[model samples]
Target: MGLAAASSEHAPVAACGFAEATAVLRRLTADDLERVNETILDRMRSRAPMIPELAGHLLRAGGKRIRPMLTLAAARLFGYRGLEHVKLAAAVELIHGATLLHDDVVDGSALRRGAQTANVIWGNKESVLVGDYIFSRAFELMVSAGDLKVLQILSAASGVIAEGEVLQLSTQNNLDATFEMYLAVIEAKTAALFAAAAEAGAVIAGCSEEDAEALRRYGADLGVAYQLVDDALDYSGAEDALGKRVGDDFREGKMTLPVVLALARAEGEETAFWRRVIAEGRQDADDFDRARAIMRRAGAIEDTIGCARRYAETALASLQDVRGAKDEACLRALADLAAASTRRSN
Candidate 1:
């Protein structure tokens, strides 16, 4: 799964809603985000020249920084006024950035965020080492925040994310890979960080255990929905909108939900096609288009979108139980963001 977008069939309000909701979150947290950005730059300094260079290549590449924004919003939603959330938020983003660096190395990706990947420019070893450096820096920031539970959440998420990456690598190109397997990979690799980011902010804000748990679930569900959209977009997404090559997952023989569903539904020659192209990894130039056609015919992509919508709905619901802050506007914005996440085009 990579950069996600709404399918053309559901293009109108889904895309617009996502943009507007994201903007609301941005507007709400703009001041703190500025501080978080400054902290990110300030903390990244080091004696090693290549450290900053390799790290900045991707860091400055313009990611949405949504995870950190969640941290900021979660803190403010509880009326906590302190600077620790800033450190925690920055740490969340650094953790995400470090993961991306490592993911590019593992996936051998050439492009990210519409730019050449750091691994492509700096080489795999350099990218990996810098990713480690960034991880260390993230831990440093987490420690500086002085919250043990927050540390536990973020650190445990890091380990789970690593395990998820390994699990995905192990399942690649395996026709036997089930929907359960794919979900496990994504839940760990992607959802864990989202969970930790939101929960960490709430914990730092001193929210009750119940509210903290709710935010955690909210983040996890949103992450799953987001990754599901990413998987669908790998086949059907526009290249300009996705900021990366479409069909890269197919080329890599990843066992995403779409492929799993298509394979499950395939019969006769279609089964053979999936076997050859997916399990055997023998794709030609036209294979991707053919795969897309097959998924479309099988309702695999549509069902994947439908599945993502369900999770996004659950994410929205998770936030409902929480007692809203005085303004309650942030609650609406967060709900809107979760509701529209399944329709993201970038």
Candidate 2:
């Protein structure tokens, strides 16, 4: 569905660009985010020195803190006044950091967010161990929150993320990978944490079960849109904009949505070319360019963006029943941000 035009009362702020939405959220939750950041630093400390060293490396690396910000923003939307959301937001950041460390090791990635990956500098063993340490810290914070429901949501998300990773491993280079399979993998790998973060926020705020569920659905759809855009960017985005080289997924033979779509539209020789390069891992220097050309010919990137747009619309719709004018407006801005994220260059 096309975005509804904002009424005149909201016209000045109606164009909820990603940066503007983030700015609004930051303004609304500045003090809370400060506490969350402080908590993250304190909890990341360990006598093991290397643990802190490695964990701090990625923590200091520039990420938008979007996931944790979601938690903070969601809590604010419900007028939560207690300090529990602070710990929960920090826990969400820890969980996200741990996943990044582990994901680098699994992907054998050399760079992240325009910096050397912890695994690249510290070695795989250190990366894995440090990731585990951070995960433990996350759970400790969750326990400190003393909310059993929060624990259940986050812990389950952790497991689902692992399962998603393993599922992606199983599907790698498999040309026969289907759209449903890709969606399932992204839901588990990426959306699960987002769902947990938003749900935990609403739960802590004492929102009704229905409202909490709406936040969870919003997060899940937003995450899928985010990942779809990321995947498309891997093939088409500038290196500086992406914080990594373009075609990284193509180089790794990962079966992203664009590749899946391109393969589906491949003709005789084009089919053989994809199978040889992807399934057989026979890529050459020129293969990435060729892959891009084919994907463009198939309109894969546009199709992927279209898919992301649909999810973004769904995310916006999920917030319809949310109460409170201010809360609904903030949530609507967030949903708009998710949709706008798909169109960003970086």
Candidate 3:
């Protein structure tokens, strides 16, 4: 869900084979990314002065930039050498950041990446407006590229993501949620953007329609795998390690994979506890420890990890059709990174 560190430096070396791929893309796509960054800054500056300043504050926070990196990697792997990939990559990041700005408001979150959330510092109205501003600016950049297909892909993804968020909201604490329903929600909310990122890259590279389909699958599988690992970490990781409080999902009444699976397999009083307390959002002071123990007993954490691994495997398998290139290897490495993200104890 966020960046992390491993104890031995070797672990990152091992975990971030995909990260190395991005570095390679950085060298290959540096000029384009630079231009895109400059254009973004200039476009934001054209907004009323303070709006750009506030939005820019969040942009400068320096995230992993993985979405753009995936775009660049896809283009390079498909043997594309053009400026449009850079614009699409920026578009990807802008869309992602816009969602985060809104998500902080929806979740009532106070912090992100160890800094105060824009909504926390600036208020919900300002955060939402700035997020919309970024969304419009991203489209303006995309329009400059003159790629109708790119526009369609991103626009569709935006709609799917919104639907996913609302689906989750409607499903909150509804313990009857099935794994199929969960997958549907995640595919829309999380995987659709990944599909767009890869599809946009292939479009920029002038790939065949079939190859474009493959890239989309790659992104979708990776997206599903990434989110599963994030959910697992909520149970397996410590508060400091997770960069948020442990059991925060429980407190929020948000039912995740672990909770769903655990409830299905729970026994006797364990089942009653979840039904009455965790799902009902009515836990007494004494329920937390017992509920946690019940979850551990149900093998919820193991089930989540197993499901994430399956998606990682699916992601790697989707790369089989692509010809081997620097970008292809990087894509495989990205798959490895997706697998590794699920494997992490942090």
Candidate 4:
């Protein structure tokens, strides 16, 4: 999903928690993030001007930089003072950026972070090639970090993300997609990177295997909550705040969690309506409103948010045995951010 800022007018007060948590993380990682940004810009340079231009367009666009922050925070939590985490953080961001470029092309999306997507500005072929270039850069960064375990974690995550994307394509417009299937798709597509980011940070820090595993679980749970919230927001969020039209998932005929939940509760006519709109791709303008009404009646959105909160709780719990006061606070705030993601209007 495209990164979006909460609109002042449309965003709920509860959503402010995410902003606050993000601010906390940003403050904590400001210096390292600066270095990460520099590394990103440095790596984006090439003999071909368009290579930097196209990648820079999206890189300079605003985002919370949450994944890389997780990397830095994870390393710091374990008392790592080395510079390897900086390169690793940049690599994490490059991996994320590569996914976004390729994802926009795959989703046929035009907007990202309230701006025209790289694919829209540079064409799909250029976007794809540049994405490949960025992926290569990410691997280079990993090698520069000189950590075999870190490389293995990230490389495996990259493969899992690709598999998740393919799985999502297979499930698209298939209304019968189960909740378990949806969970598996998101776990692969989103959580793998998060898990790897945190785990690699711990590896770089030379933390205990158990501590590293805890951080990995924390990141994975956080990522699942984040994606579930995004899925819910597509049906309920403000257009400007979401950075794309509301109900885009519906338009795309993707069977996200809310749809999966609603389908499980649908009656005869409701079942037919979903089948016609989602499975058949025969939606009309009013269909989105009707779908929203049905989802509300079924409490699908609320249930999805509840599910997100559960994962957020699990994420927080995963950090319960961590050793530092400051690190613990930041990790808890990140968990709160995960909960707030579902509470957002954007």
Ranking of predictions according to lDDT = 1, 4, 2, 3
**Alpha carbon deviation, residue 28, candidate 1 (Å):** 0.7
> Which of the two candidates, 3 or 4, achieves a greater TM-score against the reference?
4
lDDT of 1 by residue, 60-143 (tens): 898888899989988988888999999999999999999999999988999987899999998999998999999999999999
The candidate, 1 or 2, that scores higher on lDDT is 1
Among all candidates shown, the one with the greatest lDDT: 1
lDDT digits (tens) for residues 217-245 of candidate 2: 98899889889988999988889988877
Per-prediction TM-score to the true structure, in the order listed:
0.94, 0.94, 0.86, 0.92
Q: What ranking of all candidate models by TM-score puts the best one first?
A: 1, 2, 4, 3
- What are the clash counts of all predictions, listed in order? 0, 0, 0, 0
Tens digit per residue, CA lDDT, model 4, 141-224: 989999999999999999999999999998899987999999999999999999999889888999888878988998899899
In model 3, which residue pairs have backbone atoms overlapping below 3 Å?
Answer: none
Indicate whether candidate 3 or candidate 4 has the larger lDDT.
4
Better of 2 and 3 by lDDT: 2
Evaluate residue 155 in candidate 2 and report its C-alpha lDDT on the 0 to 100 scale. Answer: 92
Task: Give candidate 2's whole-model lDDT.
Answer: 0.84
lDDT (C-alpha, whole model) for all candidates? 0.88, 0.84, 0.74, 0.85
